[model samples]
Target chain A: VDAGALDAARSRDASLTKPPGSLGQLEDLAIWYAGWRGERPKLEAPQILIFAGNHGVTAQGVSAFPPEVTAQMVANFNAGGAAINQLARCFGARIDVHPITLDRPTGDFTEGPAMTEAELLEALSLGWAAVDPAADLVIAGEMGIGNTTSAAALAAAMFGGNPRDWVGRGTGVDDEGLARKAAAVAAGLARHRGELLDPLEALRRLGGRELAAMAGAIAAARSHRIPVILDGFICTAAAAVLERIAPGALDHAIAGHQSEEPGHARLLGALGKRPVLTLGLRLGEGSGAAVALGVLKAAIACHSGMATFAEAGVADGPG
Target chain B: VDAGALDAARSRDASLTKPPGSLGQLEDLAIWYAGWRGERPKLEAPQILIFAGNHGVTAQGVSAFPPEVTAQMVANFNAGGAAINQLARCFGARIDVHPITLDRPTGDFTEGPAMTEAELLEALSLGWAAVDPAADLVIAGEMGIGNTTSAAALAAAMFGGNPRDWVGRGTGVDDEGLARKAAAVAAGLARHRGELLDPLEALRRLGGRELAAMAGAIAAARSHRIPVILDGFICTAAAAVLERIAPGALDHAIAGHQSEEPGHARLLGALGKRPVLTLGLRLGEGSGAAVALGVLKAAIACHSGMATFAEAGVADGPG
Candidate 1:
């Protein structure tokens, strides 16, 4: 359950062909889990869980667009105008979005946490029910407005580090706005110190219901032995909270990508995991998760299709 | 076609959507020929020609291995360990890989120019005859060792450009190797100047039979009104020579990708076209053209699936 044990398990596999370590990011991901669970790796069937909520912090004028765009974008996702839709078709993956607590029309994000226990429970229930027992992997992503602030608070409460280390200029914020956002995250945690003692309590104190639900979904995926692919900063923070309570929850976790957010690298460093893609992206809403799935697809094909040089009657590198 | 005229035909009413300018690369590719052909815009069943040949220039030690790698790689393509296999599967498009010469093991690139005149005639004959009447577009890609040198020779002789400017490092070559390659291309051209006079003859003199067949294939695709998608420097240069002989040859041209090759940009410029994907890549064997097909699939979906606002009951972007 400890980080040392996790690393030991990841290094357990040295029997794979081609080379001792040639698959790059994929080799680490597969090897990490193979050691933990003692099973040869495969990513044949993957599940994507999208957690949706409305942020209460939009009143700060931090976002270039309105919070209503979150719900509208979710509809666009379901209607299939989005880039992820095409990617899903290419990768042959199923997607389901869980709308928790907040919906449309402008609302105040700084008014403490608007998420209730019921909303959080409902979203978690949907995500849990969606995973088929026959599924091979699980991926978790988040969609919410001013959601970065909530994710920051969640990370602060999960890891005892400073809130400033977790808070970032999400979705392209200017320098002044980012500094103010960091200060806001610290304030939210300071105000909610009493309520956020446990992981669930931390979710109730600083995050939307969807973030709490995502925490539950990740925990469930970990227990079920399904590798959980984390999208970006928000999802990584959610995993941090899940890992705080469960300790070994990240055994099934794969850091899908490192976003352009300054906070993301700090969080990933704490997790001791490196991302596969480094495309300088900070956009959330599962877009990072969407593209990273392509790597999973390639890995799957390599695992399943590539003939060992011995089997193919080819020289091993060069004789 | 003038640049303004090309831009104008792309914006004509009854255009493919969003005034035909919203899809970026896809829109530019489809419109490049709209002005040349004086056609409002129609993309019929496309042809994707994959020409395969082994490079004789591999003897220079610029590559990690010897000339035999060229033949081994062609066999790998047929077997499918490469990236193009997956990209081709994504589109389910027609593909043809012509092996015009078997001189890789012998290391004689200028050896009677792979495909004799009769062979070139037959290869083109068989390539276009395979095109289905339902086809709407065409793409051409080549695989050959020392093919970049051949492409440069064809380009220099036809466009009368400096060979150094037209020579480029194929695959991943160092600066020292690049200089040596430039010299080899120049020497090969001087050794076979007479065959370099006629585009077809120049191809017969210094080019691989696969490159020559690719040129003829593009010419046939133009007559068939099938938009020919050029994979990289080799295919693009072959297309350039064809365009020089017949100015209207570009009527069906579609620049698939701008490769990392030193001369690909110059070739695209002379053809008066731009590529779709500009990722710094020069690996041959049809991978770029195959991946570029996904753009067409996306563009087709956008043109066909975009709701008119009347259909979706949502407001449209201000026209």
Candidate 2:
């Protein structure tokens, strides 16, 4: 964070016409944004990257939708017919859909590692290269039928929680499917025990290609000083790998929303990230982050647009 | 509200490409908005009315700022320099500021009634007339130095709560100012005990002109089928008067945000309102509601703009 820029923003916020600290979280958020975009920031180009890949764990009956739905959703995204497309339109953000080998599903983590080293590298490089350097903000989302199960396994392995605690009803799974998801998570952990010690190794072993790609995109965003809005459970779990590998790696990121998934709250708690919105959103594809994009815009609009008390000729109240 | 429109929106939501309830509160908010604007709604015209008044209760030292600051802020608003102005620009909303008798402050509620019946009616009429019938959405906000004290007294008189519970650090009041606010609230309730049995009488006795104006504007919005986004503590207290007199009078209104004021949560609970945003905002110039406008716009955009599963040629999951 740019300490000078943040201090300048704080001083400017106090000088605004309204009472000091009356805007609450918005004040802090604007300063945080200013830290990245300088004292006066404009959110002109926010990019939404949705990485889709097929999950082999869907064959274990761990999700409501079949694996083919991943590619179908990717096509839907490409056609600008998905929920994220509407949200992108709402924020005037550009949307990019990357389908990472939907024809070849990752190895079922319950049997072995989800991705080979080369496969993980390919997805990561694709995501790393996909970022637009000119974009002011980035939102990384994922689409995979059984990716939430993979997310739960990754979170449980990374944070040392019970598999059942990290599992949730992904894509409206029934009780049977929920149990199957938990079993799949536990099996994945058992199959890849010592190999999961390294966080990147954990991503290769337990996370799908789309998940690794999200991690890569988040890291790329950090490298470019583009603040990121982390999406739902799968997206956060992907970003969690980066945080585990290097502390403070996600300083440029903020959680978009606390999803309906139960593990989402636990993961956010572990990450010490308070989401910008909490409308019980669980639909991935960067929808929650896309929704929160308006909030960040509003915050910045108030910060840069509103006249200070001295300029407005308004009396400053004594605290 | 139009029941047919709401039902149509609900039906349309289920057919969208995402899971049935994956959108969560946004799905419900869009359906409610549809109830007011019909099944196909466009939120192009959102009008924000800010009512400013001077409160005599400031003589009791119940606020951080002097009462004269009300007129100064009103001038700031007129110059398009206030926080609400920036938010209005962000949403393309029009703002009309009405300063009611700022030269002649309302009578101190602790000493006597805040306004006579005629004075209350004048403020109410001004607010009712301020609403633009062509507007698709309305937001009512208030600006008064000691208005939170008036709001606390009104809430205490109407809802039978401890005055201390309703009193909060409005605009960064210190401990001494908070105590004075609570004492004033208790005195106002005691002085107008029998008169406040009627809700409108409570507004006349304990509420300031700005609060009554907000109540009037909210009622007018409801009459026009223009859904309202109620602001912080003072604004909600004003709307609460309508709900008290006529049960479900605020059916067209939704809370925009939970403010930093502690009483707001209790009042929202009593009114059966779940705020769309909880950013700890304490500014009373309709700023909270103005910030939440983006959230509503995003919801409506997703509801109306996203493609249905059949339209997108995507496979619908079992969910």
Candidate 3:
């Protein structure tokens, strides 16, 4: 989408009976939707897809925990131990976690996409088919150990940018862990022979199973005209690949928050996106986006419900 | 109220199901209430009060806008022009705006309470009379122009804090404006003699009418054993005056956020209260507290709702 559609959305936003630009990025996000859908954005209900998988890069001793933690954390998320779970409840958004082929070590760098090509498509089809299809908005979040390496490698291969520019500390890595992770990412990109084709194949080579599923979900979100929120670094990385396969795919993507990871901002900037808040957040697992989602939804509500000064008979400061 | 009680609240917090100390000041705020009510704190329909007034000290040219903007903004607050009004809807919190007193140059600052003594008592009585007996929490927020100075002076005279320590640049004033405001505050304190024998007497001297009403609401919130949230400089200033009249009143007070004001930290420290969030917010009119209220409620939910590793049957660390 060019600036024209965005402009159309803004005009719709301006007529929402609130102060001009007072609703901030929320009005902008909704306006973007208005142009895409050819109607004013209405925040009826939002859905979130949380993709869970183990990374193929942790074999390099990148993370403090093992791949088994991934399965356990999945249970925790479903049971509401994680921040994202609480956020979903708080914002009244429904979240469904989708598992993308979990397999044991090829070291912790488990080869992703355990399903065969045809089977992978079938699995993705089933998952998307399960969604009730009436959701007004969508967000994709990923949870897997050592996933940032997978994200960076996919980001580098997909964006045609320096692999080094795409690497950063994932969770709690110091300078040393970051350096090691970057080197591993470089090797993964080289291993793929720079061949970033079908997303599942990319997952099998340089990414993780969760990434492939998330990419499909992002594409689905775009096709559905629902604003898909990018959660933390890895979600954006997959978003980058999906955006390339289907140009203008990112038009539906909203960068939720800036990550503490060095490369996350670069990824966001490369995609021409801006984050809603910067709280020095380093925790991933959709925490950043989950918090940001509340803001987005609140902004939408502000745009939709607030009475214009004219309607309220209050004077606005002169332009 | 005492070290022992505060310690008990802190100890109860560490035992909650979520990550240790993860709920932030919400954990502390809850604990503070445990001391107040001698039980765990749950935010069951918390109520917030916002009072509106203008300052006698404003004639010194300390603010970026005219004092009349105070009343204008109060009307805006009631009609939902500022962020706080939207936040009130977001959190399902109730708010009251009292147009109490102003610095209109013609009103006699020395003759009477910001409101009549009877009016001050009636507002306090009204606050006392309004709370739901079954409510689990309460919060007080004040919206007064140039009221930060009065709060500081009130703090200095009654709370036994230094004048410089209690004063702060409010609503984004320049250095020169802040200096003049500080001087006027000192003069006001000298003129009034800080007589706080009655809450109304305090109002007549140094308190904005809205500030005094806020102080009454704070007293009511404490007496009810419902947590009262102090937003930035103005609310905290009013809280200090209320506490001076009722020394045990700090029992349920919770500083909502660490504001950008120079004296906010000092005021919070004097109360032995730590703010739930440090967002550098200095804008008054209950916006800071209102924004923090959602997160605080989330924190309560986290503490009360999350399952432990043992209950969830998830591995805590490396197995």
Instruction: Kindly report, for each predicted structure in the order presented, the TM-score of its chain A compared with the true chain A.
Output: 0.84, 0.99, 0.85
Query: For candidate 2, lDDT tens digit of each residue in B106-179?
Result: 99988898998899999999999999999999999989999999999989888887998999999989998899
| Candidate 1 regions with alpha-carbon error over 4 angstroms | A1-44, A61-86, A103-109, A114-130, A145-206, A228-288, A291-295, A308-319, B1-48, B58-83, B103-133, B136-139, B145-206, B215-283, B288-303, B306-319
Give the residue spans of candidate 2 off by over 4 A: none
Top candidate on lDDT is: 2
Query: What CAPRI class is candidate 3?
Result: incorrect
Give the candidates in order of DockQ, highest first: 2, 3, 1
lDDT of 1 by residue, B1-319 (tens): 5566566654442232121232334344445555544444444344556666665555554443345545655565577654455445545666555555655322344333534577556655655554544566666666655677667766787777677898765644568777777776677666676666777776655566666667766776666655666788887777676777778667666776677777888878877886765545566666566556655454443333343334433322211
For model 1, what is the alpha-carbon lDDT of residue B101?
60
- For residue B170, what is the lDDT in candidate 1? 64
Better of 2 and 3 by lDDT: 2
Interface RMSD of each: 6.6, 2.0, 5.2
Q: Tens-digit lDDT track for model 1 on A1-319?
A: 3355455434432332233333444445545544434444455566777777777766665554467656655676677754445445545667777666455422333456545566556655766665656566677776676788778877777776876787776755668777777777777777676777877767766777567667778777766766677878888887787677766668677776787666788888888877865445565655556556655554444444444444444443323
Q: Candidate 3: lDDT over CA atoms? A: 0.64
1 against 2, candidate with superior DockQ: 2
- The top-ranked prediction according to TM-score is 2
Top candidate (DockQ): 2
